[model samples]
Target: MMNIKVAPPYAEDKVLEIIDAFGHSGKTYWKKRNTIKVFEVGNDKWNVKSFQVPHLINRFAYKYVRKSKARRSFEHAEILLGKGILTPKPIGYVEYSQPIGLTNSFYISQNLSYDFDFGDVIDKEFPDRENILNQFTEFTYQLHENDIHHFDHSKGNTLMNKKSSGQYDFYLIDLNRMKFEEMTYEKRIDNFNRLSLTADMIEIVGKKYASLIGQDEAKVIDDIKKSCEKFKEFARRKGRWKKRIGL
Candidate 1:
């Protein structure tokens, strides 16, 4: 079975053209973890993410018990927009299934050309670094206030654009891994675990977030730092295990 769902405001014909060209080739944006291709159709740009095929158990689960990643991504984008959170406009999604299970899937969305991501700030010095970090912290606060737990709220998942109005606009990508539930204070702080690389960055975000939430800044910083360190250690251990198993 194959399914395609497009946003109502977009022209269906143009969307069909992009969908047709997705299986072929275009300008590649991401090809390492998953494959993302950019296509120019008419005057607009579209991004089609061809999700890597899942493992056998996951394939069956996605086919039977859960929605495909592409479908989840499309729906999550709509949810974010409804909540006044910025994400790329979802174009559509395509899912292909066979007798065994889901074979392949692709998520389509408008390409957001932004200044840079949080990763850039982590690695290099950006102008107005503290201000940007504060705004990002506020953004995360907003998400937590609304009970939107973005599981993969990592560095590169967020795109920042300095608007002409002299404010930073943020948009989140990679939307499939998310949870919508009331979050505890500890869970909220842990959400930042995957975001920063250094203690300074953690301190900046934790302080801003703590101020907004009226928590002790030092306590928030300490909690976030410990969570980040634990996550990093787990990642390192996982990497070693993967290597040992020849994964």
Candidate 2:
């Protein structure tokens, strides 16, 4: 928001053949955890996005996950899509192997134009903010209903695309830290609020979510609100208390 992004080197050469029709390419960001490169293509006109695969990151992520997880995260998108959740479609993914000294990956998806982070928009207003909020709510709900724990739910990872003539679309990025699982109501609800929205944003968005899904009069919504606080508090403590063993 405060600072606009710049393009990565070789952006022109890497311009996705399909997306070239949109316009020029520019602005690339290293998505958190080295999961992928989020590129801002084109200019002020109709800027698009190019997801350049998750190459490298060393942590609990890189060593532990097998190719199966990558497949799951991508296939997982289909589940969300089926539930009416809006996210960038995973067209394909590249891989790395021992035979090759170096490995790289690229995930191709059409950029959701008009998309920006909530942190970026806090200082500005986008039309259909309510719709954006509602869609976001459903997205979180879907993740929880299915027990997909997004290890990092920060506002930065949660992006909103506001179209001038239509409703906004919500996308969840940074899959490396996600904890996909089947869990109880409390854990699922708590997982949804672990890192993203602030207290107020969560309350407002959570309420909007309840309204969109059902009546908030029932305590389910209130329970979710409380769980959000609890989860965040736990994640905060867990992060601070970790020890660097055998590092």
How would you encode candidate 2's per-residue C-alpha lDDT over 36-62 as one tens digit per residue?
334543541222332333344522243
- Give the residue spans of candidate 2 off by over 4 A: 1-27, 35-65, 68-70, 99-106, 120-131, 142-151, 164-166, 176-184, 211-218, 242-247
Residue 10 error, candidate 1, Å: 2.8
TM per model? Answer: 0.95, 0.57
Which 10 consecutive residues of model 1 have the lowest summed lDDT? 11-20
lDDT of each: 0.89, 0.52
User: What's the TM for model 2?
Assistant: 0.57
The candidate maximizing lDDT is 1
Model 1 lDDT tens row, 1-247: 8777889877766766776777686799889768999998778888899999989988898899899999999999999999999999998988888878898898989999999998988854678888888899999999999899999999999999998755899999999999899989999989998986587888788889899999999999999999999999999999999999999
